[model samples]
Target: MRADGSERIVRCNEMMLSLFQCSTEKDFLELTGGCLRGMVIAEDYRQISAQLGVWQREKSADAHYLDFELCTSAAHVRRVDMYLRRIEQDGEAFWSIRLMDANMRTLMHVPGAMDGLLSRGTFYQEALRQAMKDRDMHVFGSHCPVYFNITNFKLYNASCGYAAGDRVLSHTAAVLKEMLPGAILTHLAADSFLVLAPANRLTARVEQICRRINHFIAMPGVEVKAGLRFFEAGDTSPVTSSFDEAKMACDAAKKVVKRSWAIYRKSMSDRVVLHTYILTHFTEALQKGQIKVYLQPCMRVLTEKLSHVEALMRWDDPQHGLISPAAIIPVLEESGLIHELDAFMIRSVVKLLHYQKENGLPIVPVSVNLSSLDFFEMDPFAVAEEIMERYGISHEYLRFELTETAVVRDKGTLRQALQKFHRAGYHVWLDDFGSGYSSLNVLKDYPFDLLKLDMAFLKNFNQRSRDIILSVVHMAKKLGIHTLAEGVETEEQLRFLRSSGCEQIQGYYYGKPMTPEALYAACDKGTYSVESRAESHLYYHPLRGHILRQIRKVDASQTAQMMTFSAYGRSYRVTMKRIASAQALHIYQAKFEDITEELQYDDKVRQTDDVMRNL
Candidate 1:
């Protein structure tokens, strides 16, 4: 076969034609669209190309082998093993190709085969054959199709390297074979497997397999989940459909806490219907402006002003009325539509900022959330930069927020991106810090300007939780990373966060997510004041400590107190009022007004009165 761009077949023997059920070379060429690339199924061609590229990079390796499904002249899909040897003939690159029936190859001879497991193609073929045979047998002979997925497996690979990931996969395959002997099983690509287990005791077997794999991996926060579909007597559904059903069950199992497996039920089909609807209507809905960007204001703890706002997405489907992000995000992520939505959000936020600046409205930095899929689907940094340039908005007014899980995708690439964002004068924030198992590792690896503490810490408020939250805030402060506590709803939580030295607070305590117009109105009405960048230094000065102590010492019964203070050679009058008092702790709201001129005028009047009295 010619390895050149043409993918032409140079030569073939009679056996090759016979295997493809072709009478002559012309028939073979016609069946394969006259190219070597056309021999393998479209889905597997990319994998084969990648493998070949890897082998080419290793110049010492002249020969490589792969197993893939080939389309026959009769339009049948058959698994074949191909041996490709790189050849250079008269300065032209070529490949000497040999094909064999994959079914005839022993498990040990299959290239890159997992231990004790058949390749995906072989397994699917065998499973289908078994299903057909079982159709003729008694109901007692039914088997359950099971799909296993290792949760957060990509994170494991990124942290432990691909070699380690492969070992984990091999170990899992070995465990499944040992536990379900005589059952057909196969490695179905990266951290997922397909197995046929006896209908009886299937749940026990699945639990045992998951336990064994987790034990072998010995990694904290890593576990396996199984989705099962019990085959019934006289059922005629395709084995491929059963595989998909099991996968759907497994996906559902991932969401349930403390459940390692889920059995397929008819009720699960509703999710499929919803998934289809979302994919079908997403673009149209977006075009119609059903999807909107809502801003949740973040208040600076010291200044008690709106330092920034996090842009959250809300979908208002005409049919569905209102859809929560919890329902929409996972679907979009699985279908890779999150990239489109993310890009749209970036554009929306930039446009909003541009509007604010042009309309003479207070413009604070707006943070846009980025999913891990964003990096894989598109160049997120480039997209954001382009949008900012188009809107003529400074990078400083646009912030990027990525969850802890997002950084684990590719630390090296994300690290460089973070550096690029910093160089462009953009602030990068880590959202939901401490929500994952690898929070410390993320902080150590990535250069984030702000850390958004996961709201979970404040959800179940207690002394222990308080201590943990304080420690995290202190640790972030020591690392020179600003901290923001999310989901704060009560004065106790607010007081604790403020006392812990948390720089920012974002949650219902300040305000819930609202439309852009609402946010502008709030600022315009003085419901929330935007932080002044020019006086930002004042919030950090030691003088704030004295003022804070004074507010803390004031009695709750006092309606308000007026006090004069001098800072930076200017006298200011501070008004302190108790906003809330509970559990013996008083929360004070303070307003500061510079009274330099007012005080000087009063002093001159007092002197004039004294002169008049003396005369």
Candidate 2:
């Protein structure tokens, strides 16, 4: 304590620090970089004699540089990042810094670090970020006393109206500011505010502040929401992409406990983090024509023909590299965005269909897969019928395939819902036939025109009996059902289906799913489509695969990285190249941290970019 009644804050200089009351003088020392400089160590006979024998190192008054490093946690690292942000907010320079971990261990000894990029601190930023997302907010990269510790980012009384909530927010912010002077404070949307402070030797000061907020919130007139996010002095990002994640936890809290305050959860995933990024890019790709429709030809193998093409959506998710239907589809489902994807495909297909009809081209039938949810919301017939009529399309030019699951789950209402199309002479094909036993009963009970065999039967071709494939073929034929044999990969399989009297074939060996131009070229000249194909070389290595497989056996992270791009459509060789890259997190980090709308306005990254700017 200073001679004055109020405690004087510790100054950066030793002269000011010495003014504080210390239990022992021995603990007081200046910090200097490296092991041999300004170190406080146990006095040993050999070291004491050696030190006494050597010249005493000069400590210049102008140096100001310390030999003693700060002790910090990963939480403290987050605090440091916040401090930089706070300083930057004040239009101050955020200097690059080398740092120390909890044990006063030198984590980084950057040469000319003040002018260099803050690389070491960046790891903590990412590490703390991941830690927060994974809900392990406790794991910090450093152990420093100077971190601004956030217990939770919760609201005080959301149950109360805006007036009461505003009062509590004001009181809470004031208390934090008073306790943590010169802290970076942000009003992170409605009742939540964040404070970033330097807490070196200020644990008592921080606890007292938390206690004050706790006391203030418990008073009952106005409740408050709060969460603690603590980290070491210097780091990257502590929370998720934004305070919204913390606020989400707060919002969830508001529903149940109606607690005045709660801690923020680090419970989101790196994938989830990346999703926030890709969503924007997908939007941009749609606008910029980067999202192109690749047509997977649903064809007849016996005739070696182009039947019709299923319009599949593909995006080079510039920020995430390439995002696939498999990776992005679940998100679309969650966001109720599957309809938008379907609409995009429908609109694109309508154009192609219009072109085909206009040119008097031999237009075969193409079908699209409808989600069960989508089918529930909008009648499949209506959507298809309207698009066809609008584009001058005939029902013969478009086939509609509903999954067996969609069929069986529909309470037999699809028959009624889709009665107009069937009556109007549009073909309805039952997709993934063998997977669902109920499909057979539905086929018998309902008015169905065609059946597409499930790829599962073909996946087990070397093992399954020919009788199994033939039974399906013969039954459909006897029932006046036209059959499309899917997953026909090999020439042998194609010939076998032909001899067995299958009506159509669609699979990689016939020629992979292609665009309209690609469909024309590959179908007309049939070796393979190289330009837009995922051959084994894109991801798989023959000799390299063997080596990588061995390397992957020992490395879990590398093996996990390998699973992202899997070939799904290949019957024999569905060349699995991921529309998105294997390194999703890395891609997100690169795309986000440095994003500017003026530079690369990736649709997925804009919001994240905005939030990161605030962070």
Candidate 3:
């Protein structure tokens, strides 16, 4: 083939004519329009031209081999392995070429002037064949094959729109090709890509590529991370193994802090195996009594008495012995099996309540935790009601506790359940009140019986945290809601909570969770104190301007009288006296306590009657 303006074929043998589907050299040239590009696919002409230009610039002494798709006269694409070199013939340079099929056995013999170039025994033929055999294995050098994929690709596609995701994929392809030229690329899966490059090349550049991908995607709630599996030179396994490892690495990368790329590790495989085993056996374990409820006591801070016990789930796997709830619950919740486990725990609590009642023991409130999944999976109110009915217990004995995050996630769905529970006379306490983003907002919107402060805050107990806790407690008090402190493990914490007016405390210092028999024994020993049984009278008067006054004695028939009282740097005054009296007792009542939202005062006073009636 001549590298000229016309790109004419200088000469061709019978075999070349046959391959081009022509009878003679002149006939083949005429059929191909006397242009070399006419016999090569138009799409590949630019790459081929670049390769030729590079070879010509180097003035290679040896023949260089290239694989190209050749278009024959019959319009059929032939895979051609060509060994060509620049030859100066008659002071006009042209390409001396030997065309062979990819197999290297059958020769599409071009009529070359040099007999050495055409000999099958030539070392160039062996070198070309060996290079072709290892073509897919090496990129620029004796490098490795790495499998990579964008993390959460489906999520990105769904959230960012498929068209945008497609653009991202296309942009990534172009960047990879441009940045790492000569790297073999393959699209193995929808989001997975394979690149054959030196291990060092991939390791040094993958992070940059992943960061660029993440930046380019730039969609909210859509992130991109790449995982890699590098193959050494000696690896003989199929390329799919690298892809599988890359997928595993991608999952592990999600847990890596601030990292966009991860290399495959064996621990990832172990975790995946354990997760799979747990998910497979969770349901059966629940039925086999392997999953049980553990009770933790919450005591009244002032009374030093048991107020309620939080029902916590624990797994006692036969093979694994005791599995921490922390270890299993998350997997169950993610798998949506927490719904059944929650139901089991609820029924178990009800049965325990029934057992306590039958045994003539004190039946304190048992607060069972309900996951956010419960509301969406089934009617949580109906579930609670059914358990109460099955055990023939009152709803008052069963208090439901939900995490702040759960309540905030689906306020409408949970609000309906909360309203139903309120109507049915069940107390709903917001668990881990200050552990989430919208604690105060949730407090303002949701009607909760109690707020359980997370113990995590008490771990430090610095001045700032103390102030925050006291302020939260004061706010809850002002709202007529009680606050309970969880994870209290020291006398300092218990005393601080008691001094801060926290209503309840639960922690390791009091006692670890006990079995049913142990709890029964502790209850009999008065493990919690009862409030003093004495009742006394105090003068009370309602003021018109959000105030109250206390007096030693006032006439029951007295009319409007203005009196002032001061507490906590706030002043209150009595505006009217509307009293009803017994023979030796005087009664003065106000619609609310000292702290009230005056704007909703009248409405709250009205609703209080209805709420009390329902209770």
Candidate 4:
């Protein structure tokens, strides 16, 4: 249109005519009745004129913008970005106008040569920006932006080739255009699309479009699942967020065979946020002492002795208190952080051993778990040896527990690593033996000193389960491997396991997992034993009178709070005695006595000789 008030028709370029699917300028002009105003929709003509009037009145001579729907010569309507600049030519005023088809702009953003649709990356980004700007205005009536993608496009490309994939994309675009006329459509990425239309219309029509797209792309070893997320007019979130949410939905859809579509939800986003938080803070948490090592004692069922303690990792964040291993270990494993965490646990166990020796406490062998990633991080046995040696601890004081999953992940390397542990004189136990499908096979191949049975077998106590456990125990014993029943929380279960010849039992019924200090304290108390006092006079009121008589008989110059007592015809050692005065004449106070077993070998030998002589 001319800048002069006449609004005269100007020359049309051949390319512009081609965009309207016209062969020649004459044909296009005839279709529009040879008038520029006739090319625009009748409802938008007045606004276009008013905006033009404002542009002319300003006298800035700058290019003015008009975004309006154009009714083209081919009887098709498209949104257009028109740049109108005022100019003077041949001593007269005119307007140089450039028409940019919104559809073509979208197609331009696509990477390849696309016809009849916008697939250009630049166009897709611009469309998103424009959609966001329009949404911010809150004037685009009840419209929603929907994002979708072809789920199996990669498989299709891999099987059929890129040319066939391109055709599929073209066919999909054509179907979408026909189904959703006047929609603001943009091809987002390789196989994803964004469409803006009336909310009610989109919700009603998206399912049908998905069916058509799936059918169009259907082939042997090829399927198309569409995942869609709608950004409703009432939603205050920006349009850019739609892609991520929709992508998540699409991924979720891909996991289900029967489902072809999924909608984004808040819970999915929350899970993503949590996973990201754990991954981001893991290293910092380890350095800040939030990650700790705890011990759970594995006791021998036959001897009721503390065989060893298993080292388990725990996280206690200052903000989110006590994150469970079930919650944090997966993130660590997935993020490859488990390797470093496993190393840290090994070092912590070594430090615990060192601490026990320094404090004159009994040094117990501790077993630490290793991840499959630990092998990739470094030589597990070598690392363990290095830490133990650095702390001046022996390899005999440490053991390694490897899960069936970790061992099966890389059998060759892990087997080699396990062999190295054996060579280093450290016990390598296969943990969670029956948790995996390959447990029996793992047992056959790997050289494990012990088999820690998975707790699942004990969850539902039945005769069949019992038989299965008995068979496993029998097999393990035949293979010269001991079995440990984990999660043994009942007397019945403990009795059944003991009868089945399981070597160890570790669970709540025996004891729960405890800190180093608590474990040390329990071990310091040692095992309890029952004895009978043959002489009732010394045993009467044994807590006070007997202990007081023994302490009074001890000479302070000869012994330091030490005395000997006889019980069951054997002597016992009493130490750490304290005495105080009592108000009653026959009563005396005795405190802080430790009575331990002290055998009378000479008395037993003389009794044996007298019995022989009598016989």
Best by lDDT: 1
Judged by lDDT relative to the true structure, which candidate is superior, 2 or 4? 4
Tens-place lDDT digits, model 4, residues 1-615 = 576655667778976687556788887765554454555644355567667778777766787787655544433345577887888788777778888865455345333333445454554565466676666787543555566678657788998899889888877777778888766666755677766655565655877887787787877545555545665556666554555566556656766777766777766565444444455466667889999888888876544667678888888888677877876776666545578888889888999999988998777778888888888867777778888888899776787888888777774888877887888778888889888768877988898988998898899989988998989998997887868989889999987887777877888887787888878777667641111222212322344354545556543433336555655545545553333222321222222222433244566788999999999
Model 1 segments more than 4 A misplaced: 1-145, 148-200, 209-225, 230-243, 251-260, 265-268, 276-284, 302-304, 319-321, 327-337, 372-396, 444-447, 521-590, 594-615
2-21 per-residue lDDT for model 1 (tens digits)? 66544567777899998888
Residue pairs with clashing backbones, model 3:
305-529
TM-score of 4: 0.55
What is the C-alpha lDDT profile of model 3 across 1-615, one tens digit per residue? 765534567678887887766777776765555555545543345456668878777766578887655544543335567788888878777888877754245322222211112222332334234334565646422544455567667898887788777677776766666656666654434465556554666766877777777788776545556667655555554443344456567656766758777887666555544454455556667878888778888886544666678888777887777777776766666655578888888889999999978987777668988998888877878877887887899776788899998877884878877889889888899999888898988988889988999878899988888899989998997887868899899898887777776878898988787676777777778775422111000111122123233323234336545544444444343344545554543344332123324425867888999999999
- TM-score-better candidate, 1 vs 4: 1
lDDT of each: 0.77, 0.49, 0.66, 0.68
Models sorted by lDDT, best on top: 1, 4, 3, 2
lDDT at 184, model 2: 47
Candidate 1 accuracy as TM-score? 0.59
Indicate the worst ten consecutive residues by lDDT in candidate 1.
104-113
Candidate 2 deviant stretches above 4 angstroms: 1-270, 277-284, 359-361, 523-615
All candidates: TM-score: 0.59, 0.43, 0.59, 0.55
Full candidate order by TM-score, most accurate first: 1, 3, 4, 2
Q: What is candidate 4's CA lDDT for residue 521?
A: 76
